[model samples]
Target: MDLDLKCKTPILSYSDDEFKQILEIRGKTLEQLPEDVNIIKEWLKMQPHLPMHPTDRQIVCFLIMNKFSIERTKEKIDANYTIKGLMPELFSKSPLHPDVQKTISLVSCGFMPKLNKKLNRVYVCRLESTDVVLLDGYNYFCSFLEMKTICDFSDSDEYIFDFSYFPMKMVTKFNPMDFKRVLTLVEKVYSNRIAGLHYVNIPSYAEAMINLIISFLKPKIRERVRIHKSLETLGEFFEKDQIPKEFGGTGISLSEICDNMNVLSKEYDEYIKESNNARVDESLRPTKLINDDFLGYHGNFKKLQVD
Candidate 1:
């Protein structure tokens, strides 16, 4: 299936009625898109700390991801820039930096071209080689998330993490502290309200590590995590055809999906370059800001200044 990459809007597969129903469920409508976007634009003008002016489409996406809560949308936008401004190790790099490109070769990860019944985007990630580096993998994910946050339109996302070839010795490959940082950035910065976190083909040795990761999730989200022993079980939530062919579904192969992702990254390269500079100026922040909790640092915003 072709990912409608030519358009500046979401990859259009949903019929108008279905799309409207999804919007209505979130207390939003196509009619309110422009008005709500304008409201956010006006709000941005008042925040001296934030420098970026996002597109109308990005604003609408933030609104949907936040369930149409304008207040939450504003907070998400602020955190999006604030965290990026503070963490150069992850966010400040170019989307297609060498490490990120190397990660594409090391792992197979991509978003499904179509939305699930709940209209949440589906993502599948698999390790291809035991030569996995957590930092590189995260950089790849960050690049992908950044591009999606700006370019794709989706309210929420569900992830299928395939640990098929993952080595048992590296169960501790990703530190718990690093995991927390990544979790906060995705949930707070991009407003990625996760619908489900499904794990398939988990090795016996990795149970403790998986549990540690789950411990970091909010209770509601933790309840949504499922450890699958059988691929058929996933059918309870995802459509049979949409599941990647690697797992017995008739849908697009994960490799092909990654190819689409590569195309997507290229298409948005210029946009990422321009927006990476869009960050919060801590000096101008109107309220008291303490980042003692972000990425495990204890200090005022000025102490952790990245830009």
Candidate 2:
């Protein structure tokens, strides 16, 4: 597998020193990987009839997530396509309907425009309203995948979940299956991208909500989850200027960030549309579907203790 380093846009920007640090962690150099373009070419050679050629940045994301292990990267690439094919509702096409957009907007999630000194991007989410009925899990998941496309530049990501205004009623509305599906994709397909997850102003009763979500993560990732009693505590992990004003930081407000993401999401519309066609043909695949396949899991939501 050849690496294609030529990205049309800066997916993740790193200084020369930071780039070296990343390579050292992976035990490889840019020269060894070259450009990730070759990696996509090799994948095409193997599959021969994939619906679309993944962008170089997307290929780099798989490579970085897999620690530059060619074999592991190949497996993730295949699984990525396979999952997208299986879960078109979440992976293919952006949701542009007015109602769908309104539902997603109500979720109050957006990526911060700034990166930390380490260059890890920050994702901020909050529930500004108590109308849980207004939130659509499928649309939320789709928006997440859309946001994930722009997060490819950095190998690590930091998440801040602000639950200051979280409604207790919203807890029961949580869809465990949708939650599990998102984690499944993150763990199986977008592995090793999350560096840290911080929960701020968490209500005491919301511990159950956190526990339910954490149960889906691996041990290492579970360990990365932190609950903070105050914004000051979160400030220890990130600079004040790096944080958004909505969170008591000096940066722009969450509303502004969401507005910017709205524009950026539109730009990804075509890519998402094309992604719908990138499904895997099961008959042509060398492996048979198993219970552990992307969409194989099925059970009662009651089993997840959502009630």
- Model 1 C-alpha lDDT per residue in residues 38-142, reported as the tens digit of each score: 788898988888877666667777787888888878877777777666665565555476767776777888888877777778889888976766776775677
At residue 301, give the lDDT of candidate 2: 16
TM-score attained by model 2: 0.82
**Which lDDT value does model 2 have at 201?**
87
Whose lDDT is greatest here? 1
- Provide the TM-score for each candidate, comma-separated: 0.88, 0.82
Q: Deviation in angstroms for 219 in model 1?
A: 0.7
Off by over 4 Å in 2: 1-20, 35-40, 132-151, 286-307
Q: At residue 131, give the lDDT of candidate 2.
A: 58
**Candidate 2 structure quality by residue, lDDT tens digits, 1-307:** 4544432233233455665566667787777665554755566677743555556656666777788777677767776666665655565336564655776667676766655777677888888776544335465455555446444455578889888898788787787767777667777776647789999988888888888888877798889899899877888888886688978898678887777667656766566556655766655655543344444533321132211
- The backbone clash count of each candidate, in order, is 0, 9
